[model samples]
Target chain A: DVKVTQSSRYLVKRTGEKVFLECVQDMDHENMFWYRQDPGLGLRLIYFSYDVKMKEKGDIPEGYSVSREKKERFSLILESASTNQTSMYLCASSRVLGGNSPLHFGNGTRLTVT
Target chain B: AQTVTQSQPEMSVQEAETVTLSCTYDTSESDYYLFWYKQPPSRQMILVIRQEAYKQQNATENRFSVNFQKAAKSFSLKISDSQLGDAAMYFCAYRKGSGGGADGLTFGKGTHLIIQP
Candidate 1:
């Protein structure tokens, strides 16, 4: 089975702090995604990378950036954490984009900004 | 932009019974894919079922199935013989057929499923 690992399961940060959320997938999938899961809004995509060193902005990319210097690792960076940034962040990987390639998600990291 | 809607914020069903979660979407593209994902409490989210737009038949996985209506732009999930472990926050997602996986999925506000003993 494919496994996506997030470095932290729970995180606490103060306002104006820079935060880094790490994700690594064992299956070496080509597509990696970062999403923020909230109570009512569901999972909103933050950023995605299709290849190493390549990234694309999702619907909600403000105040967030991503780095994919390696095939197995993708990182999400919060430039300046704020109270509004407190939410569950999820990391997912897929072989490709299509019906045959289903997304496999890692246990999310719950971030609390104080 | 594509949008997905899950009207039922919460639903409860007895064990061994059946329950359906509703989802509707609006998109201008003709080809795309629909999916139902389950996120158990404090666990990783997983794909439960998926349906291709071109396929006329609905997709099913074990006891989980989807009612995909292409014309109406609705995709609902039906779980039969529900078990206690079936409780979760169910999300409906959409992705365009193209993009080779570059474009991320557009998800709806999830429906929380509760299993009653």
Candidate 2:
């Protein structure tokens, strides 16, 4: 079974604080994605990385950035957390894209900014 | 750009009954992929079922099946014998089958499914 482990299940941070959400996959997938879940908006992609040290911005990537230094790990960084950024963050990994590949998601991290 | 729409924001069904969640999408490309994902009360979300645009056969997985209408761009998920565990937020997503690089998935708002016991 493919497992994507997120470092924190819940996180609380104050405004203007920097936050780091880590995601590591065990299946050695080549594609990784970070998404934020908000009420009525569904899961909006924040960033996606196709390979090591490669990244691309998604629909909502204003206050977020990503780092993929290795094949199994993808990190989402909130440069300056705000109250509006409080939402559920999800991490997913897939073997490859452009085919019938399905994304395997990790137990998401719920972030609350005060 | 492709867009997905889920008309029903919330749906309720008694246990052991059948419930179908409505999903419609718009895409210019003829070949693509549609998916239904389930997210429980917890944060973990998983794929429920998937249907290919080119295939005429509707995809089915156990009690979960999809009603794919290509001409109308509709993909509805029908869950038979709904159980308490089936209560979750269901999301409809669309993705282009072209070479995957920067083109990610486009997801709809999602529908909340409630199972009444």
Candidate 3:
């Protein structure tokens, strides 16, 4: 079984604060992803990294950035958190891209910006 | 770019009955993969079933099975004898054939399944 561990299950931050959400996968998967999920709107990809130190913007990457300093770790940084940014963020990892690999997701971080 | 669509935002079914969730996708590529993922309340999202484009046979997992219409570009999940535990948000996703460049699942808005006892 693969484990995608998220640093925080629930987070609360003030507006205009810089927030960091961390994710680490035990499996040495080659791909990692960050997503924002909201009611009515499923999981929207924010960022994805295919290799260490390599990242790509997803469908919605406006106010977010990602860092993959290590193979097992991927981090999502919110440069400036706002009330509109409050939503559930998910982290996922996959063995590789081509093998019909299903994403293994973390428990998710419910972020609240007030 | 490929896109997935789950027209039904919510569905309700009785326990011990069967329910089907509809999913359709648009893609110009001949080869790709479709997936159904479930996210329960306060639980991590998990894969329910997956279908490959080239395969004629549909994918099934226990009571969960998929109705794959390649020509129609439609993939629907049918759960037999639904249980309370089956209640969750089910997402339909599409992934292009693996070669290089862009690689990641394109997801639909998702359908919320409600099981009635």
lDDT of 2 by residue, B12-109 (tens): 99999999999999988888998999999876889999998999999999999999999999999999999999999999999988855565588899
**Candidate 3, position B71, lDDT:** 95
Q: Provide per-model DockQ scores.
A: 0.64, 0.70, 0.68
Q: Model 3, residue B95: what's the lDDT?
A: 90
lDDT of 3 by residue, A1-114 (tens): 999999999999999999999999999999999999998788899999999999988889999999999999999999999999999999999997765889999999999999
Task: Find the 10 residues in a row with the least total lDDT in model 3 chain A.
Answer: A94-103
| Candidate whose DockQ is highest | 2
Off by over 4 Å in 2: none
Candidates, ranked, lDDT: 3, 2, 1
Model 2 TM-score on a 0 to 1 scale: 0.97
Binned by DockQ into CAPRI classes (incorrect, acceptable, medium, high), candidate 2 is medium
Clashes of each: 0, 0, 0
Better of 1 and 2 by DockQ: 2
Error of 3 at A14 (Å): 1.1
Cα displacement (Å) at residue B93, model 1: 0.6
Off by over 4 Å in 1: A98-100, B99-102
Q: Residues B10-104, candidate 1: write the lDDT tens digits.
A: 99999999999999999988889899999999679999999989999999999999999999999999999999999999999998877553564
Per-residue lDDT for B13-101 in model 3, tens only?
99999999999999988889999999999759999999999999999999999999999999999999999999999999999887576
Give the interface RMSD of each candidate: 2.0, 1.4, 1.5
Report fnat in order of the candidates. Answer: 0.61, 0.60, 0.60
